[model samples]
Target: MYKAYVFVKRGFVSMLSYRMAFVLTLLGTFVGAAQFYFMAKFLGEGHEFPLLAPYGGNLMGYLIIGTTFMSFVGVSLNSFQGAIRGEQQMGTLEFLLMSDTPLHQILIYSALWNFLYACLSTSVIFLVVVFVLGMDINVNLGAALFILLLSVVCMSGFGLMSAGIIMVTKQGDPITWAFGTLSGLLSGAMFPVELLPPFLRTVAVALPPTHALIALRKTIMVRAGLGEVRSQVLALLALTALTLPIGLVVFRWGFNRARTDGSLAEY
Candidate 1:
């Protein structure tokens, strides 16, 4: 935990050095939120979407929840791989690996800042949507938070798998790309998954993000309790169980292979 704190502090200091970039990022987030707010309004045409009935039939509320959750998904999908890639590019990965710290701990600590930043950005977006844009959303805060945590854990498993591939190949991570693309299209990030065809709907159901979004929308927009979102919660838990161990095994194997090949320092 102390080690993680040090890493987080280092990351925060580094980010603070780039004040302009930080400001620009915040500005970009606001713009993105505003664009989505208007788009949802236009799409809804002052009428509720039948597909969004579970989320209180409010288009803005539905999109806001989706957008906020998807931001976390993006962070969890890229954090580990981005950390590894950054270290390798900076010629620091080998030095870090030589330390007494476990490789997994190092990876997790490195990505901790990105996860924290993503959460902060999500909160900022949510506030802007609700206060500035006047989007009406009823939230069960505790349940929403729990669902978001589960979603992050599940997505981080896939991120670890991508990091494993990066360790070996050094680039060209098809897993991260494919998963990100598919999740955006099928995970109800922008629209309801119920609108998809039957086969695509089945595929959507199998993905963790789909269930996460469902649970989030229910809990946040519809003010549902944990018990009301029991199915989605169980689905996310099952995905976490299925993916996390496999991700760890694959990452360990890739790390060993990279070390054996003396390629950890290679770009």
Candidate 2:
């Protein structure tokens, strides 16, 4: 816990050190939300798309929730890989590996600050949409949080896998790319999955984010209880069960291979 706090403190200080960048990032959050707002307005207020029936048919709110929730998902998916990449680039990876801390723990701790910042950014988006844009949300905070927790765990499995691959490849990873691109298009990030062709819809179901966005929207928009999203929750749990072990095994292999090849500091 103290180690996690140190990482968070370092991240906070690092972010504060770049005051202009930090401010711009916050500003960018609002800009992104506004862009969605206008796009939603362009579609006409209260315009009901047949596919968005489960989400109460509010496009703006749907987009806002999708983007906001996915920001956290992005953090979960990218932060570990980013941490590994950053350490390698900074020539600190070898030194960190030599320390008493385990590499996996280091990677996990390194992302704490990023997850915190993501929370702040998502908060800004939610505030703007709900308070300023007058979007309605009947959020069951507990259920929403539970779904998010599961989603993060599911995504982190992939993050660990990506981080491991980066340890060996020292280049862009395919796992992150696949999820970032495919999930954006197929996971109902900006639109409904129901709008997709039948085969595409089947493909979307295989992605964790597809289930996450669906459950999150239902929970936030319709105040669905945990039981109401049982299938999505179960799906996330199964994915987590399947992916996390593989991620750990892959990470172990990559970590050992990197150590044996003495490539930790090469990148």
Residue 139 in candidate 1, Cα distance off native in Å: 1.1
**Candidate 1 versus the native: TM-score?**
0.96
Local error of candidate 2 at residue 220 (angstroms): 1.1
lDDT of 2 by residue, 1-267 (tens): 998898889888888999999999899889999999999889956466878778887788789888887787788889988888888888888888888898778987887788778877887788878898888888898999899878988989899898889889988889989888888899999988888999999999989999999999999998999999999999999999999998898888888888899887766
Q: In model 1, what are the clashing residue pairs, if there are any? A: none
Which window of ten consecutive residues has the lowest lDDT sum in model 1?
Answer: 62-71
**What TM-scores do the predictions have?**
0.96, 0.96
What is the Å distance of residue 201 in model 2 from its true position?
A: 1.2
